[model samples]
Target: MSGGPAVVTRFAPSPTGRLHLGHALSAVRAHDLARGGGGRFLLRIEDIDGTRSRPEHVETILRDLGWLGLAWDELSFQSERLDLYTAAQGQLADLLYPCFCTRAEIAASLSAPHGPAPVYPGTCRHLSPADRRARMGQPHSWRIDMARAVERAGPLTWHDAYAGEVIADPLAQGDVILARKDAPASYHLAVTVDDAAQGVSDVVRGVDLFDATHVHRLLQALLGLPTPRYHHHPLIVGADGQRLAKRHGAPALAAMREGGADGHALSDALRRNMLPAGFRLGEA
Candidate 1:
């Protein structure tokens, strides 16, 4: 780790599910990175999805982290920062537009053979003033005008500890949602704002979000927010050679704790890159 600003890292997990081994690895990495640098580690609950987030899950998250001996300097919840996200959306108003497309409609539009997740085609980008006015009362999400935003921000770049300097290409995921009808902020918008607001200097997480960093870099540029150095670590995979998830029967940290498994030992094992019988780290 190069010497500079005091590292500020965060373990941000959504309260929609319990902490699994993958989450444990991420949290321990972020915690160690901050503490090792004589910096700060924060615990943030990403509960922006009101429909899925639950209070019970949040409690379990705190309990699990405590058991693992990862004490945080600060704690926060995304649900409590609605105004910040709203303010960010306001700042980017000129580069945003209302998107009223439903999931079914979007899926139908991209019925042709494509990638696992198809980029959204701008169906409502060129709507006339009257057309937009007529749909103002309908449920809608605010999406970034990718072309205009990129043009305004010019070229952009961000650094990852593993991948080195990366040229941002936010255009690949066209017009992503910034605010949703159900939630005040989408993951992309809220995370960018929160990381900046919390002064996170080092973002340590799984490699699954490497591509998402491109979009986040663009957002930081557009919002005039500082970009943080990222560390996209490999994911914990099961014996089946798949990333662990609830569907794969990934055992939760809560279960381990209840079973009287030693949390410190588990944390040490993870930090030392030691895994249980059938688990290993891999880019999934």
Candidate 2:
């Protein structure tokens, strides 16, 4: 099957919020990439964040996709695949460590300018056995030891359709959380596991996650998963030159559809790279 059909693509969206125009563009891009070439288009619900994800939003997602004339060949839910994430976490035991630092504590301990997210200072990374034993049963999160993980994985690179071959620098993000007390897996871990498990050959998403691809590439190497070709597309922003978000009051697809906008017309416009009034495309 060396040349069997085109590579499979997916549109994995979180059910935490309503699908907006930006989301539609991403879904349409992924869907067209697969369907236009006679390949399969898969849909995966990234509902790992149970606190925010809502059933209503999931239903809206389905309806929105249908309205957009998009159909996926297969569907998957992350909530139902806990065992897979757990198994992947176990495999990285050698490169994982417990992070007992609270958000406030981390903020107070940062002496260097680590930008928006204060890179974890590794305060509890080398805690003595006695200290760890005394703090047993305390709420904590699991983080990958970036230094060790990078060393173990050696030099790694991933091919991006837009950027070409890119070298991975996982340490740039520091020790990203892999597991929390409430959630078994983080975005980095779950996404890496799911893409591999679902046999995703192409990753099409917004460029805002371009930097994250570096960490994912490293994780794929460490987890022995095949690296998928990436295509980080530009994001759709409002006329204010800001990326659309809930706070920005970007109109949701459901709202537009309810407002009498034709679904097929909208889809056709997006396919032609046209944005709605007061919205424009920008690279992330």
Candidate 3:
């Protein structure tokens, strides 16, 4: 914990599944970061995906974190913050365009011969005003014009504890979705907005989101939000060297808690980087 304003960190997990050891590692790290700096730890339920987010899963998350001897200073649910996200999107209206391309259409476009690092080919980026107006009745997602956005917010950068200062290159990711018909806000938009709203000064999570931080830094500049110092820690992996997930048979925290495992002992082990058998931390 470096010297700065009191650190406010969050463990925002989607309530689509149970909390596993990997999730435990993230939560403990965030908790320690906040507590170590005499700051606040927030428990935010990223239940923006209405279809997949279940109330039971959220309950299990609470139980799991509690069983691990972790406590949060505040709690929030993304489902209740739709209005804030919508307002944030409105502020970036000039940089956004409606994307009419379906998943199948985008996949087909990417399948053709293209650059080594494939991204959205800007299929709907050049639509005429009349064409866009005519398609207003159809379902579509709102995508940010990456080139225009980059030009508007020039020479953006953010600091990471591990990666150091990073120059933002959001253009490589193409026009990313801000809003969709199925969801009021995309992951990128919602998390950026929520983090700012919560006054999170230190973002501690997995290194996998390092690239996404580039886009987030740009968004913070565009939206006039503060850029929080980031710490993208390594991910916990199983014997196969794959990140822990339900598909990989990662044991859920609830299961371990229910099985009479010592919560504080497990928490201490994770803090000391003592992983269970056949598990280890890996780089992104």
Ten contiguous residues with the weakest lDDT in model 3? 111-120
Query: What does candidate 2's lDDT look like per residue over 133-209, in tens digits?
Result: 78868998999989999999999999988889998988888889999777879999999999999889899998888
Window of ten residues with lowest summed lDDT in model 1:
111-120
Candidate 1 deviant stretches above 4 angstroms:
1-3, 111-113
**Lowest summed-lDDT stretch of 10 residues in model 2?**
1-10
Tens-digit lDDT string for candidate 3 (1-284): 56768989999999988999989999999999999998999999999897888999999999999999999999999999999999999999999999998877887877575443357789998899999999999999999999999999999888999888888888878888999878999989999999999999999989878878888988998999999999999999888888988666689888989999988899999999999898999974
State, as a TM-score between 0 and 1, how close model 3 is to the true structure: 0.95
lDDT of 1 by residue, 1-284 (tens): 55777899999999888899999999999999999888999999999898999999999999999999899999999989999998998899988889999987888998584565668899889898799999999999999889999899999999999999999999998889999999999989999999999999999999989888989999999888999999999999988888988656798999999999999999999999999889999963
The clash numbers for all candidates, in the given order, read 0, 0, 0
- TM accuracy, model 1: 0.96
Pairs with steric clashes in candidate 3: none
Candidate 1, after superposition: displacement of residue 111 in Å?
Answer: 4.1
For model 3, the superposed segments whose C-alpha errors exceed 4 Å read 1-4, 112-118
Q: State each model's CA lDDT, in order.
A: 0.92, 0.88, 0.90
